[model samples]
Target: MKKLLIPFKISLLTVLFCVCLTNAGQRRLGTSAANGLVIQQIILKGKVLSAVNNEPLAGATVRTEIASIKTDQKGNFTVITKKNKGTFTVTYLGYQTKEIQHDISTSQYYTIKLDPQQNTLDETVVIAYGQTTKRFNTGSVGRVTAAEISRQSVANPIAALQGRISGVEITQQSGRTGANFNVLIRGRSSIANGNEPLYLIDGVPWLSAGISKASSVGSQSPFNSINPSDIESVEVLKDADATAIFGSRGANGVILISTKKGKQGKTEVGLNAYTGISQVGHTMPLMNTQEYIEMRAQAFVNDKISPTSVNAPDLTLYDQQRYTNWKKNLIGNTAHLSDLQLNLSGGSDKTQFRISGAYRMEENVYPGDEADKRASAQLNLDHRSENEKFRISFTSSFSDYKNNILPTDLTEGIYTAPNLLPYEDNGSLSWSENGSAVYNNPLAATLRSYRTKTQNLVSNLNANYSITKHIAIRLNAGYTTIATDEANVYPLSSFIPNNSRISGESTFANSDFNSWIVEPQLTYNRSFGDHKLEMLLGSSWQEEKSSGRVIFAVRLQTKLDTLG
Candidate 1:
């Protein structure tokens, strides 16, 4: 028994010694592994830039599994990590996020270039009464950027929207410069009301003057008053989801125009001017003297009438050998256009401002005293409190337009007989002969005095206050005034007969439109665990007044014109 007990004790001691040795070895291995990890940890530095323009991208984010950092204004960033090899992601707005598996232990500095995302799903878009991202939009909205608008030089801002937008049809009523155009979105929907889309310039509805259709006198487009160069973007809302916010005004469609605003940066002064000439695209081929004689003779034969009959008196007028291209004589071959705009913009951390002045002159294709001239000025200001809880903005614009219009149908001059001379041998306008059809001289029709002047003032003021991170209130007030005056004069020389009862005719018209609007809104936005909720409650009050008067007179005596 004593021998067995001694062997058991010895075995137990040996087992205990072996366990202690194993534990010691394990401790040593753990220490060495900890030391290795310390050596692998490193600091990595990089600079980020835009791949397209190679511009430095500030505020870019760099993240690792255990750490994160942001790039400075100089586009430089640094991060610390605990692994020699790990994946790092770099992200920036409007750009694709990039991931890189790099051995931080090997390199200290890296130059990273990020590419812009081609998909516009993340792009921000302006909606009615607010702003939203394309991803959140539930309606079909077309957007035109300033870059696209700047590519084309157009007389009217609406002209820049042609062919660029879907479901929109823009037709120029006439070839004359500054003429009104017919803009139909999703085709015409109203038969009694105007089919023109509602135009909103900087959140204020524009009071468009005149009819959308062209008249015998001329066509006037209020859109011409706006300078295209000053526009920053244009948004067209076609579907119900986009247009419903506008209520009744959006029955046809809605057009939102955003003007250029000051940026939070250094002052920028821009000067843009362009000069060009426009000519008649095509000329109508008319019958010359010989062609007219042949055509008249054929007409007589077709009517079964003898050319020698005295019924067709004064046939010698058609016997003239001279020929004239009436189109060239009435509608000038070319027109001149000139536009100049000057703008200055700048801002600080709390305030920003942009002011601009523009002038445009466009000569019509008509030869005599037909042209359009416009002068405009705009001022925009924005202010924000240091806490970023309170904000205010003001926008004001004024424009004056003068149009010298031709009073007659341009196509009529094209069909006149080439043998008919406008001036007689004594330099007097040749009236219709005793036995001939009465025809007024085309040159005299163009020389008649007709003019229209329009003046517009648009102003808006907005204020916003934030009660908390999730609640805010906004107020918008706007006023617009438009006045137009038109006058027409026909001189005694334009009359057919010297003893005409109406020696001269004159007409004058004046119209004024005034509108004011106020809107107050309360917005609440909150987010919870990957879910976001937003609610908006708003109400608007608006008023519009219009008044006009027209005066007409047929002067039996020239001195009666002085009575006015």
Candidate 2:
């Protein structure tokens, strides 16, 4: 009996010791056991102000690891933190960010001051020949930065300037993927010829304005070939100041675009990808079958004409119970949008290079195998001599896109008798009803297929050599070429078999545009007291050529842009 009791007591003692250890572990708290870092919650107050004038910034935001807070009207804020020694950042609308790290072991209040970004008067603005400050530039100019353009997130770069720039009016002509945009700078300037501003992409004159049918659904702009992601900046030169460099071509205005270049840094690769869906926001309500019948009958009575099978086929010949909502059937589906952009950039002080590739797809709202896809690539290279007196740069871009949709208008179908059906029970067109030929079928036009493929390539090379510190000579050259192929097919199902003479028809078209330019310039600059004098001597030679071929075929007629 004594031996059994002794063994039980020892076991009880060991169990008691384990419980005591567990309780002590739970009570011990100060540093995290996982990372061994001290975490003490604390709250502090701060003030945000401008560094130069010491004025309060009413809308500054202060962000820390634990909390984000904004300054009050008096530039005061309170923030909660997790550490006694902490770092935080402060930001304002037009001010440079200010960061502060403080050992708050003893202090209660912190202060932060931020500096304003460079004033607009001192900001650099790109001009016709070179860059100048906004204050010193004599001509009217408007500029948009890469950050602003990226925020728009539009496939067409022209759409980015819709409400951004004043005096420049941009209107979208279509809702298709590669839609056209009419851009008028300072209103209309021409009567017969095109009123388009000269467009330059990295010193290369582009064949974007007044393009062919392959470029857009119903318009002539071809700005889609230029990817918005590759642009570094856009400068709009308005008035006659730019005409000195480009002659009469620049009489209206000049839109100069600069692409992104490699920076002097370590090698870096970046990727941008996005996908989304779109649908019609709102649709108009149309009359139903009963209402449409009453309206048609009233129209004939008002015109003092009797309704019959020949005069009013929809009311007398078509099925009385049939109903068709043309708008919903023809243009009610969802569209898909996706894009991917990848780029590699790196270099040294003496030489730098950048390369980028992009692929984008946009689906149509029409219920068919219709979509637009584009693939593009760009490369840029820059080099400089050891003395920094001689420099050269080359830029090139290639783009190819295919569109399989036509601008077919279905407006007539919406107004047609709602009791009319476009097809029969056997999946064939319903062209006749009650011995009368029916022309209310909207699918007749949609059956015709239209496809187009376009390719564009642009290249530019610029070189500069300094004979002396005060004088330099430069040479600029560039070329742009575009090729397009289009095909349209019309089927017999689109027409009434008994009344129409055409059976089937088709058309094929090929168009090409080639243009080149060269400019050699000499510049001299010197400063006298507080004034500077500059002289420019330059000459420009440009040439453009365009050609096209078309083929039309007919069986009786065989197949189908602008809308109804």
- Find the candidate with the highest TM-score and give its number: 2
In terms of TM-score, how similar is model 1 to the real structure? 0.77
Clashes of 1: 0
Model 2 agreement with the true structure over 399-513: per-residue lDDT tens digits: 9988777656544456667787777789877777767765757778778888878898989999999999899999999999998888878777666565345477777888899
In candidate 1, what are the lDDT values of residues 307-359, reduced to their tens digit? Answer: 65245432454335768788887775578889899999999989999999999
TM-score of each: 0.77, 0.78
Predictions: Cα RMSD each:
12.1, 12.8
Backbone clashes in model 2, listed as residue pairs: 489-559, 490-559, 503-557, 504-557, 504-558, 505-557, 505-558
Clashes of each: 0, 7
lDDT of candidate model 1 versus the reference: 0.81
